[model samples]
Target: MLNKVFHLTENHTTVKTECIAGVTTFMTMAYILAVNPNILSAAGMDPTAVLLATCLASFLGTMCMGMMANLPFALSAGMGLNAFFAYTVVGNMGYPWQVALLAVLVEGVIFLVLSLTNVREALFNVIPISLKQAVSVGIGVYIAFIGLQNAGVVVNNDSTLVSLVSFTDHFRTSGICALLAIIGIFLTAVLYLKHVKGSILIGILGTWILGILCQLTGLYQVDAEAGYNSLIPTFAMTDFSKLGETFGQCFRVDFDGISIVNFIVVIFSFLFVDIFDTLGTLVGVCTKADMLDKDGKFAKIKPALLADSIATSAGAILGTSTTTTFVESSAGVAVGGRTGLTAVVTAVLFLVSMLFAPIFIAIPSFATAPALVIVGFLMFTTITEIKFSEKDYVKAIPAYLCILAMPLFYSISEGISIGVISYTLLHLICGRGKEVKPLMYILTVLFILKYIFL
Candidate 1:
């Protein structure tokens, strides 16, 4: 059954190798389990509950990806989307945690409906290639930003226009450590390009050892108090009867406040970001794995989309934020995860990590920072696929904008928003609007107006 489903023979990867890939992928991504709860707890949800929900949703979602999408990628509460939930929805928008969860639920249901129907595939077809590349670059920058911040390389500057680097004090230590990591990643990439086996796993382990060395030598300190604890699935007993009540109270949307304008804006924000994020992840991973169909669509995208939407809705009910497909799955793809075996491996590893959450949590973010930065560099390779030419400004400008805006705007959704808006406006002005599909035009305009004005 594994052979038939996973195509292990066709891919020339043994169960042993696939299992190793799966384990490596899990370790590389296990940071989400710790980090997501930290971010969401600050938004007022029960930290323990969020942890359980994240684990279960990640397992279920990745399992679906294995059985249905037959791709090696795994799904989880995405880094960017969760930040939006915590910071933007709960912190800035003044919504309660439960209400934010409800919004996630609504978005999930909509995603599920679209996925089960043909609309999901239709929408995937219309997205411009440039925008897809933009998402890749944006995610890269965002991941890099995460690494720098976690390493304490960048910090808030009180007097400057924005935060600046902590150049004076921690420079020598953090700089040397980060440099070692970067060198490790580069060596791994070179080996990978040369077709060396297990290069990624080796590179990651090497970088981790360097971090441990830094800690032991007093160059860095490990926070031993932040130990890991096992995650037990407990949301099965939560009184979902209050789901509606909890949601309503959290959002505080009175009938008088629910104008057509606000409702449309909220809906558009949720839909546009989720759709494009999923689309870009799918395209980027598919491109890396050579899984794109001749028509430039992922053949099994429907199930993948359904899995993502279901994961997000499940996360909401379990008390968390929007769950989406992670761009980091490209890491697995880059290392030869071409079949469901890869995803199944990833899922099994996530399930096991639940048993050792404490150990998983114990590893400092700096330890994982190397993997994040490394994956960012790997995904950044997609930029080479973009065509650069005098006549290509229409595509190039928006793409470049998206690449740059992700880190600057500090939000993948915002970067995508700007990219789509730029793409649509440019195409229209250049008399090339007919080249873009009608649905894309409509969605692009709606995203721009909703995000910008409303």
Candidate 2:
């Protein structure tokens, strides 16, 4: 049975090979299960509960990917969506945590409905290839921004028009560490391109060891108690009252001074980011896996989207913010994960890690910083696939803007919004408006109006 299941010979795949692939995929993506909860917990949610929800959702989503999509890709709460949840919804919009969860739930329900009705496929078909490229590049920039911020390379500047590098003494340690990690990523890429096995793991491990040495030499101090471990397995009881409060927050139906217009803006913002983020991830990863059928549709995308939406809804109920498919699955796909078995393996690892949350918590962000940067570069490679010779700046401009603006704007949604709006206007100006689809035109106009008027 083991031999049959793991066979990888010319005639048959070996169980050992499958297990190796599964484990490799899981390790590559293990950071998501931990990082999502870490970010959400900062917004005053119970950390342990968020961790549980993250694990459960990831496992369930990945399982669905395996069972339904039958692809080797794994899924989890995404990086950009979580930032939108924490910064835009909760912080900028001034919505309470529970209400934000409710908004996520609503978005999930909408996503589920769209996926089930097969509207998702139609939506995928209309998204210009250039727009898709922009989305991927936008996400790469967003991820790089996250890495930079986490590494303390960029900080708020009170004196300048825009934020400047953090030259303060406190950030020096983190800054140096981040530079080293970036170097490690480049070296790893060179090695991997040279056909080195496990280059990512090697690069990450080397950087981590360097960080540890820095700590030992007193160049940097290690925070032994940085992450929340008590929040795992059974850390905090679910606050039922917070649920009602959160739901109210979601719709901005509060007695507080927050206005209805502001509430609508926040809700729509959540809906927009979550929808596009999932769409972009699905298209990018599926394209990489060659999963698109002759019709240019994901063969089993409905189920995968349904799983992603369901995970978001469940995550909100479990007391976290928005949940969506993670791009870390790209690493898994890049390494030759070709079945849902990879996701199942990733899920199992999350479950096991629950018992040792403290250990996971101990892994400094610097340790994972290299992986994020490297993955960003890996995804950015898709830019080469775009046809630059095309005369229509409508396509070229948006694609180029997406790659450049995401890292610069420090937001994936913002970059995409710019790209979409630019794409539409360019098409209209060039008198090539007929080439643009109606739904896409509407989405573009809506996004523009939302950003400008709202």
Candidate 3:
């Protein structure tokens, strides 16, 4: 039954290979188990609840992709979108957590409509190949930077804005967490080089054990006030009574006051970022896996996109941020995954992970930091294919800016905006505007309006 449905033989893969690919994919992305809550909790949502939602949503979302689209992609609460939800929507826009979630829901619904109507696939035709490559590389740097920051390898400096911590400071002041992170980096890299399956997962587990020893030997200090200091997974860590607190709160949208503009801005930001992120991941990963059809289009993209949209909407209702297809799903692809069986295995792992949510939530960012950094390096392999000749410099420049602007400006949307706007202007200035599509022109205008009105 499994062989017939997933076509294990037809894809030149076995059940064992699919399962390994799924496990590999899950290990690469399991950092989301900790990272999502760490980001979303700052916006006033319960970290435990976010952890639960993250797991459940990931399970459901990936399952949909596997069953409906027959794709190996996995979905989870996205890193950049979650940060945007917490820092921008709540902190900058001053919207409550419930309202932020409501914005996510609205964006997901819009995305769903677009996906179902096949508009999402059409929108991708206008995106330049350079920009597509740039998005992948940019997200690589962005995620790596996040890992470095979490591991205290990169620290905030008043004078420089950000600076690297000295090696001495890393071991002495940053304590056992930093120590574990450094060790995990070397260990995971070594294991990955040796072609070990689930190297990232093994690296995380090894670091977690070292952390436990640090705590037991009185070498690790627990900060109770900041809330995350436990070495074990526990359900008692968060308030479960607040599980459904953020659900169905879209009614809290206030159209009466000046808040209407802010609401629209927030929703628009969510929509733009989520759409592009999903598009980029789908294109980049599918292309890497050679899953794109002969016309260079994703197969069954409409259904795949609908699955993503449903995940995001379901995520908001589950009291978390935007859930979308993960770029890390490419980890499975790189390991020979070619069908929904990989996704099914990954989804089952997520479902099992929910039972150990406490351990996942308590995992200090440092332990998972190495996996992220390594995955970033892996994703960056696409950079070699971009054309950098004199004639192609216009495209290359925007692509380069897109890569740098992501980590430098600290937003994927900002990076994409910079690239698109630059691509539009350079083409027009160089008498190459004919190369830009009508859809590209429309996107350029929307981004401009975003700057002016939003």
Consecutive 10-residue window with the lowest summed lDDT within model 2: 227-236
Please report, in order, the local distance difference test score of every candidate based on alpha carbons: 0.70, 0.65, 0.81
Give the winner by lDDT: 1 or 2. Answer: 1
Stretches of candidate 3 off by over 4 Å are 31-47, 83-96, 170-173, 226-228, 234-242, 251-258, 293-296, 334-336
* Model 1 misplacement above 4 A: 11-13, 154-180, 183-196, 222-268
Off by over 4 Å in 2: 1-39, 83-95, 153-172, 223-266, 293-296, 390-392
Q: Write the per-residue lDDT of candidate 2 for residues 1-454, one digit (tens) a residue.
A: 4323322343133444345545655655566656776677767666666776666667777777666665566666777678777777777777766666776777778778888898776777777777676666566656656665665555567786345354445443545555665666677678678866556656666666676666667666544274212211233333334333233243443536656676666666677777776777777666655666654566667777777777777666665666677666666665565566666676677666666645545455555556666666767777776778867556888788866776786655666677778888888998998988898888787887877875
C-alpha lDDT of residue 287 in model 3: 60
The local lDDT score (0 to 100) that residue 145 gets in candidate 3 is 83
Strongest candidate by TM-score: 3
The TM-score values for the models, in the order shown, are 0.83, 0.81, 0.88
Q: Give the per-residue lDDT digits (tens) of candidate 3, residues 323-430.
A: 999877876776678899999999999988876666556676787687778777876787887799998999999999999998898776788888899999999999
In TM-score terms, candidate 3 sits at: 0.88
lDDT of 1 by residue, 1-454 (tens): 7888777898777776776666667767777888887888888766666776777778888888888877787888887678878887668767656656667777888888888887878877666776776677677777767766664445567786346454445444555544555566576667677877666767666666666676557655433353312221222333224334333233453444334554445555666678877876776667656676666666788888888888877767766677788776766766667777878888877776666666666554545566667677777777887778979988999899888888887766677778878888899999998887788788787776665675
Best by lDDT: 3
| RMSD to truth, every model | 5.1, 5.1, 3.0
**What clash pairs does model 3 have?**
233-358, 233-359, 234-358
